[model samples]
Target: MTTLLPNYLGGRWQTGTGAGSALHDPVSGQALVRVDATGLDLPAGFDFARRQGSAALQSMTYGARAALLVQIAQTLQKHRDAYYEIATANSGTVRNDSAVDIDGAIFTLGQYARWGAALGETRALRDGDAVKLDKDGLFQSQHLQVPRTGLALFINAFNFPAWGLWEKAAPALLSGMAVVVKPATATAWLTQRMVQDVVDAGILPPGALSVICGSAAGLLDNLQPFDVLSFTGSADTAALIRSHPAIARQSVRANIEADSLNSALLLPDAAPGTPAFDLLVREVVREMSVKSGQKCTAIRRIFVPQAVYGAAADAIATKLAKISTGNPRNEAVRMGALVSREQYQSVQQGLQALSTVTQVLYDGRAQPLIDADPAISACHAPVLLGARDADGAQAVHDLEIFGPVATLLPYRDLAHAQALAERGQGSLVASLYGDDAQMLADSARALARSHGRVHVVTPAVAQVHTGHGNVMPMSLHGGPGRAGGGAELGGLRALDFYHQRAAVQASPEVLQALGL
Candidate 1:
C-alpha cells in the first residue's frame, strides 16, 4: 500500500477516507505516495483559520511578523537537501530547475521579511498625505489600508509547486492574513513536506498555515466575504473561480494568473552574428528547456526580422540540439520529463494543432531516452517549429502547449513585429533584443499596452539582465487580458490585494491623534 500523505487543517493533522489518488514518479512511473481530501471538515477548518489564526497573526506588529518569516526561511533552508530529493523523484526536475522553485520560495520569503521589518510597528498603512477639506486645515480626509480579518486561499499550478505557494503566501502573510494552500496534486510532496517541517517546528501560531493536498472541490465554497483567493492555473479553471458564488456574489477578493502566450522579438538592429542576436538565441533555448517550458511566463512565440529569419532559426535549433532530455537522476541529462502522462498527452495534442500551419525546424520526438522506459516514463524532447506567414498562423498565437515547445515566426520590421506579438492578445511578458537604445525604448512602449512587463535586452546589460520567464519578486507578475487581468508581487504593492482601503474623514486634531 502506498503511504497516504496527511492534510494539515484546523490546527491538527488528519487523513482522508479511502485509498486516495496515487502520486507517481515522472521518471520511472512508480507510485510514490497518495493524497486525498475526501470527508474532511473543510467548513470547520476555514472557521478555525478565520478566528484563531487571524487573531494570532493580527495581534503582532509588522516587525514581529517579519521575525516569523525569518524563522520560516531558516527552517526551510535547514531541510533544503531533503527538498531536492523530493523534486527529483516527484517533479522530475534537474538541480537547477529545482532551485528555481525551492530556493526561489525561500528568497521571496526573506525579501518580504526585510520589507516588513522596515514597516516597523505600524498596524495600518497610510495611502498618502492628509488633505484639507475646506482649505482651512480644520478638517481633513485620510486614506488608510488595514488588514482584512480573514484568511487567504491559494490554488497553485503544477509546474511551480514551491515558488507558486510562497510568492503569493509571503505577501498575504506579511499583511497579517492566515494562509491555506492547495498545491497541485502531481507535485504536492515537496510542498507538503515543507509545511510539515514548519508546523512541527511550532514557530507559527496554530491554524495560521494549513495545507489541503487533494481535491479543492469544497475549499472555495467555505470562503467568507472578507477572505481573499489567489489562483495560478488554466483559463478554464480561472473562469469557474470567477463565477463561483464566493467570488461573484459574496464579493470576496480574488487574484488570478492564467494562460499567457508570452513572446520574444529580435529588433531590426540585432542582425545575425551580433552580440544582441546571440543573446536572443541563448535566452530562447533557456526559456524553452527550463522547467520543461511549463512556466506561465515562458516564451511561446519567437519573432525576428524577415531578413535574418533563416539565420535565427538555425542558431536556435543548433543550441537546442545539444540539450539531452531524459531521467533527471542521470548526470548527463539536461532536461527532464513532463509532470505526468496527462501533461505529455496535452503537449502532443498541442504540437499536432500547431503543425497544421507550421513546419518542424527541429524535431526531437524521435530522440532516445536515457535510463528510462519509453512505455512508462513521461519524458519528451524539446521541439522547434517555424511559420512562414506570421499573420496566418492563428493557432500559433492561440495555443500554449505548457511543455518544451515554441514556434518561430518572421516579421518585416519593428512595427510588423510589434503587431505580430500583440496577436497573443495580452501576455505576462514581451522581451525585445537589440543594440539601439531609441529603438528598444520605442518598441517597449508599443508592447507595454498589452504586456504586463516589457524586458529590453541591450548589449550594455546582456551579461547582467535576468533571463526571460523568470518571475522576479521586485516586478509585477500578472498580465492584463487573457493572462487573467490580475497584479501581484511588485514590492510592497502586493499587500494591496490582502488589505481593505478606506477613506476616513475627521478633524485635523483627530486625524493627527489617530496616527494614520
Candidate 2:
C-alpha cells in the first residue's frame, strides 16, 4: 500500500484531513504517494516556529548554530542513499541527476556550516565601517546584522526538491531563524522523508524545521510581520504571493526566484571546429538533457554569430541526436523523463507555442526511447529548434519552453549577441564562448546589465569550466527583471536575507560595551 504523506507541523508528523493529490512515478506512470495539506493548522505551525523554534535558535551563538548545521549535515549524509532512491523513483531522474539534487543538498549544508564557522562567535555581523556621528570621536554609528525574530517560510519548485530545500534552509537556520518548508506537491516524497530524518535525528530543536507536503492553500494567510517568505516558481504565482493582503499589510519580507529565458552566446571568433565551438555545443547538449532541461537556470536561447549560426545549430543537433531518453534506471539512457504526466503535457503545449514561429530542427517526440515506451512514460527526446530570422521572431525571445527544448538564434556580431541576450528582458545567467579577451570583456560588460551571472567560456577555462547552468553555493544565483529582483546563496551574502540590518547611533564607549 502506498503510504499517505503527512505534514510535519508543531514538531510532529500528522496525516492530512482528506484525500489529497496523487503523486506519480514518471517511469511507470504509477501513483507513488498521496499528499494534502487539507485542514492543516497553519497558525499553529507558524506559532510553534515563532515562539518555540525561533527562541531556541536565538539563544545560540553563531558558532553554536553552525555546529548544529554540521550535525544536521552529518545526519543527512547517513541517509544519502535513501534520499537518492526517493529522487529517482519520484523525480524521474537518473542516478547522476539524483546526485545533483540529493548529494548537492548535503554539500550545500556542509558549505554553509563551514561558512558559518568562519563567522566565529559573533551573532551580529557588522555592515561596513563605522562612521563618526559627531565632531567628537566619542560619538559613532554603525549597522549591525542581526537575525530576524520570526520564522522563514520556503515554497520551493518541483525541479529540485532536495537542493532547493537545503540551499534556502541552511542560511535561514544559520542566521538563527526557524523554517517551515512547502515542497512542490509533485515530488514531495523526497522532501518529506528528508525532513523526517532530520527531525528523527533530533539534530534541530523542536519546531525548528517543519514540512508541508501538499496544498499551501492558507499557508500565506498566517504570515506575520517578522516572518520571511521565499518562493521559487512561476512569475504568475509570484505576483499572487506579492499581492497577498497580509504580506502587504504587515510588510513581510519576501524573496522570489522565478522562471527566466537564460541564454548562451557564441562569439564569431570561435567558429566551427575550434575547441571553444565544440565546448559550447557540449555544454548546450548537457543543459538540454540534465533534469530533462527543467532547471530555471537552463539555457533557453542559443545566441550565435550569424556567420556561424548554421554550423552551431548543426553541431548542437548532432550532439543531441546521440542522447538516449528513457527510464533513468537504464544505464544506457542519457536523459530521463519529466517529473509527471502533467509536466510532460505542459512541455508539449510549450513546444507547440514555439513551433508556431521557429522551424523544428530536432523533434524528440518523433524519436524512439531506448528502454521505455515514450507514450506511456514521461520521456521525451531533446528538441532543437532554429529561428533563422531571429531578429524578427519575437516569440523565440519572449516565450520560454520549460523542457528539453532550446531555440537557436543568429546574431549580427558580439554587440548584437549581447543585445539579443538583453532582449530577453533579464536572465539568471548568460554565457559567451570565445578566446578573444577583448570581445569577451566587452560583451560581458554589456550583458551584465541584464544578467545576474555572465559565464565567459574561453579555450583556457573550457576544460575546467563548471558549465553555464550550474548554480554553486559560493556564487550569486538570482537575477533582476523577469528572473526576479531578489538574490540568494552568494556565500556569506545569503545570510543577509534572513537577517535584519539596523544602524546604531551611540557613543564609542557604548559601542565597545555592546561588543561592536
Candidate 3:
C-alpha cells in the first residue's frame, strides 16, 4: 500500500476524511501515494494564519525575516537530492529538468534573502521623499509601505511543483505574510515533501506555511479582502478565479501567470549556415525538448523568413529527431514522459486541432523509446508541424499544445514577422535572432508592447546570452493581454504585491515621528 499524504492545517498535519486519490509514476505507470483533503477546516486554517502567523511574522524586522528565508534555503539544500528523486518518479522529468525546478527554487530564495538585507530592519518602508503640501512647508505627505495583515494563497501548476511554490512563498514571507499552498494534484508529492521538510525544521513560526494536498473545494470561498492569491495555470481557470463572487465582491487581490502562445522569429539576415540561423534552430529544439515542452514560456510558434523557411524547419526537425524519449532513470534518455496520462491525452487533442490547418513535419508516434515500454508508459514523441497557410492558421496562435510540439510559420519581412507575433495577443516572452542591429531593435520595440520580455539574440551575443526559455529571477516574468497582465519577480518591485501602500498626509514633524 502506498503512503497516505496528509494535509497541513492549523499548525499540525492532519489525516482528513476521504478515501484519498492515488498519484502515479508517469514513467512506470505505478501508484506511489494517495492524498486527500476532503475534511480540511478551511476557515480555521486561514484564521490561524491571520490571527497568529501574521502576528508572529509582523513582529520581526525585515532583516529578521530575511534571515529566516536564508535558513530555509540552506535547509532545502541539505535535502535537495531527496527532492530530485521524487521529481523524476512523479513528474517524469530528467535530472536536468529537476535541477531547473529544485535548484532554481533554492537560488531564487537565496537571492531574495540577500536582497532583503538592503531593506534593513524597518517595519514601514518609505516610498518617496516628503512633498510640500502647503506654501509654508509645514504640511507634507509621504508614501509608506506596510505588510498586509492577512494570508497568501498560492495555486501552482504541475510543470514546476517546487519552484512554483517557493517563488511566490519567498516574497510573501519576506513581506511578512503567511502562506497557504495548493499544489497540482498530479505532481504534489515533491511540493508536499518540501513543505513538510520546512515545517518540521521549526525555523518558521507555526502557521507561517501550510499545504493542502488534495481537493481545494472550499479554499477560495474563505478568502477575505486582505488575503492575496497568486495562481499559475490555465487562462480559463484564471478567468474563473477572477469571476468568483467572493473574490470580486470582497476585492481580494489575485495575481495570475497563465499559459500563452509565445513565439520566436528568425530574422531575414539569419540565412542558412549562419551563426544566427544555427542559434535559432538550437534554441527552438531545446525549448521543445526540455521539460517536454511543458513550460508556459516555451516557444509554441516559430516565425521564419520566407527565403529560408524550409532550411529552418529541416534544421529544427533534425535536432528534435536526435532526442531520446523514455524512463527518466535511463542515463541515455534525453526526454521523459508526461506528468500523467491525462496530459498525454490533452497533447493529442491539441495535435488534432492543429492538424486541420497544418502539416506534420515530424511525428512522435514513429519515434523509438529507450528503456521504457511505449504501450504503458506516458512518454510522447516530440512533434513538429508547419502551417499550411501562415496567414490563416488562427489555431496555431490561439490553441496551446502544452507539450513537445511547435508550429512553424513563414513571414515575408520584418514588419510581417512582428505582426505575426502580435497575433498571439500577448506572450510572456518572444525571441528574435539576427545579425542586423536595426531589424532586431525594430522588432524588439514592437514586441515589447505585447510580450513581457523580448530576448534579442545576435551573432555577437549568441555564445554568451542566456537561452530564450529561461525565466530569470531578476527580470519581470509577466505579460499583457492573453498572457495575464500580472507582474511577478521584478527584483525588489515584487514586494509591492504583498505590501499595502498608504500616503501619510501629515505635518513634517508628525511624519518624522512616524519614522518616514
Candidate 4:
C-alpha cells in the first residue's frame, strides 16, 4: 500500500471535499498514490502563516532560526531514503540523481544555517553612539533587514522537487519569514512527505511551513504588500506572473529563474587530442546526460574553435551513441525520462526549434531509441546539433533544446567565438577552456552579458570534480534576460528576494531611545 501524503497546515493534518491528485511512477507507469488536495483551507493557512507563522518565526533571533534550520535538516536526513523512494515515481531519475537532489538540498540548508550564523543578526547596521553633523550630534541613520510582514510563496520547478523548495525555504526561514511551498503538481509526493517529516520532527513552530496541493489558481489574487513570490519555470509563465497587477500594485517581491540557452566556449588554443579538447568534449556529454539534461544549469550550447570543430562534433556524437536511455531502475540505463507527457512534448518542441537554426548531427526523431517503458520514462536519446556554416549562420546563439540535447557551434577566433556565445543574450553559466590568462580574462568579459557563472576548464583544473549541474549554495543560479534576472542560492542575497530594505533617519536623542 502506498502511503498517501497528508496536507501540513497549522501544524496538523486535514483535507476537505476537494478531489485527490494522482501520482505515478515514471519507470513502471504504475499508480503510486492519491494525494488529497481538495477543499484545502487555503485562507486559513495563509492567515496562520502570517498571523501565527510569521510572528513565531520572527520572534526568534537569527541564531535561533539558523539552529532550527540545522535541526530540520537533521530530521530530513533520517528519512532520506524514503524521499528517494518516493521521488522515483514522478521523474525516472536514477538513485544517484535523486539522492543528489534530496540529500544535497538538506546539505544546502545546513550550509545556509552556518552562513546565517556567520552573518549574525538581521539588524546588520548599527551606529556607534552618533556621528556629529555640524558638531550637534543630533542626527543618525540606521539600516536593518526586518522580516516582511506576510508569507513567502515559493513555486518550484519539477526538475528538482526537493532542492528547489529547500534552496528558497532555508534562506527565507533563516531571515525570519514563514514559507508556503507549492511544488509542481507532477512531483508533490516527496514534498508532502518531507513537510510531514518536518512537522513530526518538531523543529519548527506552528505555521512556519505550510504545504498546498493541487493548483495555485488563487495564490496571487489577494497578495499583500509584504508578500513574496519566487518562481522557477518557463519564460512565458514568468512574464504572465510578473505582469499581474497585484504584483506591481501591492509591490510584492517576485524572483524568477527561467530556463535559458546556456552555452560553453572552447578557446582557439584547444585542439583535438589535446587536453582542452578532452575537457570540452566531456562537459558537453555530461551535461546532456546529467538528470537526463533536465537541469536549468545544464550546458545547452557548445561553441568550439573551427580548427577542431569536426573532432568535437564526432566526440559528442560518439558519447551520445554509447549512452543507454531507459528506466532509472535499470543499472545499464544512463539517461532517464522526462517528468511526464507535457515535459516530453516541451523537449520535442525545443528539438524542433533547434532544427530550424542548425543541422541535427544525431537526430533522435529520424532513428528513435524508445525507453523500456514507452509511457513513463519515454524521452529521446541524446541528440547533437551543429551549425552547418558558422560564418553565414547565427542559430546556436538563439536555439535551446532543453533535454538530453546539445548544439555545437564552431568559431574562427576567440573574439568570434565570444561574439557567437554572447548572442544567446544571457545564460546561467558558460565554460571556457585554456591555460592562457589573457584569453581567459577576455572571454570572461565577452561572455559577461550571457553567463552568470563562468567555469574555467583546463588540464590543471580537471582533476577534481565540482558538481556542474548543481548550483553552489553561495553563488547565483539565474542569468540576464531569458535566464530570469532574479537569482537563487546567493547566500544573503537570497534573503533580498523576501525582505524590503529602507534607510531611516532620526534625531540622535530619539535614535538613542530607539536603540542606536
Candidate 5:
C-alpha cells in the first residue's frame, strides 16, 4: 500500500479516514502516494492558525519574520535533490522544468526575505506621507497598513505545485499572516515534503504554516471574515470561490488567477531572417514546451504580420518539432507528460474545439515517445495550429488547450494585431517582438490596457529578457476580466493582499506620537 501523505494541521500531523485518493506518476501511470482529508477537523485548524499563528507572527518585527524565510529557504536548499526526485515521480517534469518550480520557489522565498529585511524593525507600514487636513497644518491624516489578524488560505493549481505554494506563502508570511496551503491533489507530494521538512526543522512558530493535501470541500466554508483566500485554477472554480458565502457575505478577502489566453506578436519591422523575427520564434517554442504549456502565463495566440505569417509559422514549427516528449527520467527527452490522463484528454478536447476554425500547421501527435508506453503514459507532443483569418477565429481566442498546443494567427497590421490580441478579453501577458522602437513602445502601451504585462523584446535585450511565460517576483502576475481580475507578486506590493489599510486622522502631534 502506498503511504498516505499526512496533512499538517492544528499544530500536529493527522491522517484522514479511509483508503484515500492515490496520486499517480503522470509518465508511468504508477501510484506513488495517497491523500485524504475526510474527517479532519478543518474548523479547529483555521481557528488555531488565526489565534496562535497570528499572535506569534504579529509579535515579531518585519526583520524577525524575514529571518524565518531565510531559514526555510536554507532548509529546502539542503534537500534540493530530493525535491527534484519527487517532482519527476509525481509531476513528470525534467530537470530544467523541475528547476522552474522547485528552484523558483526557493528563490522567491529568499527574495521576499531580502525585501522583508529591508523593512527593518517595524510592525506596520505607513502608506504615504502625512497630509495636512487644514491650512494651518495642525491636523493631518496618515494611512497605515498592518497585517490582518487572520490566516491566508491558498488554493493552488496542479501545474506548479512547488512554486505556487511558496510564491504565495512567502508574501503572506512576510506580511505577518499565517498560511494554509491546499496544493492540487494530482501533484501534492513535493509540496507536502517541503512543508514537512520546514515543520520538522521547527523553523516556524506552531500553526504558522499548514498543508491540507486532499479534498478542498470544507476548506473555504470555515473561513472567517478577517481571513484572506487566494486561488489559482479554472475560471469555473474561481467563480464558485467568488460566490462562496465566506467571500460574498462575510467580506473575506479573495485573490484569483484564472484562464488566460496570452499572446505573442511579431512586429512588421522585423522581416524574415532578422534578429527580431528569430527571437519571436525562439521564445514561442520555449513557452510552448516549458511545463508542457500548462503555464497560466504561456502564450496561446501567436500573431505575426500577414505578409510573414507563413514564415513565422514555419519557423516556430521547426523549433517545436525538435523537442522530444516522453518520460522525464529519460535523459534525451525534452518534454514530459501532462500531470494526469485527465489533463491529456482535456487538451485533446480543446484541440478539437480549435480545429473547427484552425488548420494544423504542425501536429506532433504522431511523434514517437522515448522509452515510454503510449497506451499508459500521459505524454503528448507539441502541436502548432494556424488560422488564416485572425478576426474570424473566435474559437482561437476563446479556448485554451492547457497543454503543449498553440495556434498561429495572422494580423493585417499593428492596429489589427492589437485588436486581435484584445479578443482574449484580458490576459496575464502579451509580448511584442521587433526592432522598431516607436512601434514596439506604441503596441506595448496599447496592449497594456488589456494585458497585465506587455513584454517588449528587441535584438538588444534578446539574451537578457526573461522568457514570455516566466512569472518573476518583481512584476505583476495577474490580469483582468476573463483572466480573473486579481494582482499578485510586484515586489512589496504583494503584501497588500494580507494587510488591512486604514487612514488615521488626528493632530500632527498625535500622529507623530504614534510613530507610524
Candidate 6:
C-alpha cells in the first residue's frame, strides 16, 4: 500500500495525530494512501504561516521571487517523468489527459516567470532616464510593484490536482506573497506530493507555502479584507465561500474559475467532407477527451448549422465510436476514466439530464464504456449528442456536464447559431470553425459579448493554431454568466488581483534631488 503524503506547514512535513481517510488509485481501484485529514491545527497552521512565512516572502524583491519561481519550474519538470503515474493513480486520465494538467501546468509557471521579468526596464531601473513631472516640477513618480502585504488562499478542484494548484500558487509566489493551499479531500494526495517536491526544491522561502490537506471547512471564515482567495471548482462552492458576509463586508478579492457551459460552433460553411468539417470533429473530440472532459475549459456545446446538423452529428458519432478507453498506460487509449466514482455519477447525471432536453446521438449507456474497466476507479466512455429543441440547447447551455460529453445543437441561421451559443448565458470560450475569415470574424464580434475567450479555427490556420484545448499562461481562462465571471491567466494582470496598488506622489525634481 502506498503511504500518505504529509501536509507541509511552515516549511515542514506535518501529519495530524489521527488515522485519516484512504485515497484510492483511480486507475487501479486500490488504496494509494491513507491521508491524515482530521485534527489539523488550523489556528496554529494559519498562525505559523502568517507570522513567519508571510513576512519572509514579503521581504523578497520581485526579481528574487521570479528567480525562485523559475527554479521550481525546472525542478518540477525534472521530477515530472514520474508525474504521469501519480496523475493516473488519482485521476485515471490517459497520458495525454494527464499532460494537459500536469506538464501543462509546469510549462505555464515557466511562462509566467519569463513574463514577470519584463516589469523592469533600462529606462525605469537605470540611473539617468526620467519621466516629466507636473508643470511646477513639484509632482512626479515612477510606477513599481511591491509584493502584496497579505496572504493568498488556493482552494483547488479534484479533477486537476496539479494544474489548479500551480496556476494560482506559482503566480502568487512569483508576485511575492505567501500561499495557503487547500486541496480537495478526495484527491489531495497528488497535490500533497507535489507541494512536498516544491518545498524540497527550496524554491519557496521558508513559511512562504503552507499546505492544509483536509477540511478547509472553516478556513474561509477567518479571512480578512485585502486578503486574496483564488478558487477553481464548482460555482456553488464559490458562491458559498464568497457569500460569507465577510467577503463583501471586507471586500475580499475572490477569484473564481468554474466550468461553465462553453460551446464550439460549426459554421454554415462547414460542408460535409470539407477540411473545416474534419477540423470541427477533431476539435470536439479533443476537448471532450482531454482531461477526461473534466476541465472548466472543456467545450460542452457543439453548435452546428441547420443545413449540416445531420452531417455533423454523423461525423461526431463516427469519431466517438472509434475512441479507445481503458487504462492510462495503454498507449492506444485516447480516452480514459472520469476522475472518481462520484465524478462518474456526476457526468452520468449530467447526461441523463441533458437527454431530457436533447436526444443522444451516441450513447455509452449499455455500450462498452471505459467505466466498465473494473481496474479503474471511475472510468466512462465517450458520449455524443444532438439536440432538437431549446430544451436541448438550454440543457447544455445551462448545465456543464463535466466529462467526455458534447451536446450538438442545430441552428436555423448564423444569427440563430450565435443566439444558441448565447443561450448558455455566459461562457469561458466560444469557438467557430470555417475557412471564411469574414464570416467567423462577424459571428465572433456578435457573440464576443457573451464569451470570455474566442477561437476562430480553419484549414489555413488549423496547423498553426493552439487548438481549442490549450489555455495559455498569458490568456484569460474564464468567462462571464453561469461560468463565474472571473479570470485565471492574463500575465501580471492575474497577479494584480492578488496585490493592492496604491498611488503615491512626489515631484520628479524633488525625487531626483533626494537621490543625489
What C-alpha lDDT values do all the predictions have?
A: 0.92, 0.89, 0.90, 0.77, 0.93, 0.76
lDDT (Cα, 0-100) at 255 in candidate 3:
90
**lDDT at 493, model 1:** 96
lDDT score for candidate 3 against the true structure: 0.90
> What is every candidate's alpha-carbon RMSD to the true fold?
0.9, 1.1, 1.1, 2.7, 0.8, 3.1
Candidate 1 lDDT over 158-216, as tens digits, reads: 99888888899888888989999999999998899999999999988988999999875
User: If the candidates were sorted by their lDDT against the true structure, best first, what order would they fall in?
Assistant: 5, 1, 3, 2, 4, 6
lDDT of 2 at 141: 90
| Model 2 alpha-carbon drift over 4 Å, by segment | none
TM-score of each: 0.99, 0.98, 0.98, 0.92, 0.99, 0.92
lDDT-superior candidate, 3 or 4: 3
Could you give candidate 6's per-residue lDDT for residues 1-516 as a string of tens digits?
557667887567878676777777666677877777466667676666666776776665566667777888888888886777788877777777788888878988888878766653211122234455677656765444345566788888887888888888877877666888888877887778788888887777777888888664577776767568888788888788778875768877888777678889888888888999999998898887787788877888888877788888888887777777776766777777777777878887887887767777886544554434554457777888777674345556778888888888877888888888888878888888988889988988987898888988989997898877688777877788767788777776777776665433567655564432
CA deviation > 4 Å runs, candidate 5 = none
CA displacement after TM-score superposition, residue 39 of candidate 2 (Å): 1.3
lDDT of 1 at 163: 89
Please give, for residues 1-516, the per-residue lDDT of candidate 4 as tens digits.
Answer: 554567776657876354566677765666676666666667778888888888898887777888999898999999998888777667778787787689879989999899877765444324233444445656656554567889898888888889988988998898778899888878887887888889887889899998876564677775687889899988889999899986867778888888687777888777788887888888888898878788888887788877777888888888777777777766777777777766777777877766767787875444434346454455557888888576555555665656788878777777777777767777888888777778888788778767788877788888874645668888877888888888777777777766666555677666656432
lDDT (Cα) of model 4 = 0.77
Clashing pairs in 5: none
- Model 3 alpha-carbon drift over 4 Å, by segment: none
Question: Worst ten-residue run, lDDT, model 6?
Answer: 120-129
Give lDDT: candidate 6, residue 81.
69
Candidate 5 lDDT tens digits, 210-265:
99988857888999999999999999999999999999999999999999999999
State, as a TM-score between 0 and 1, how close model 4 is to the true structure: 0.92
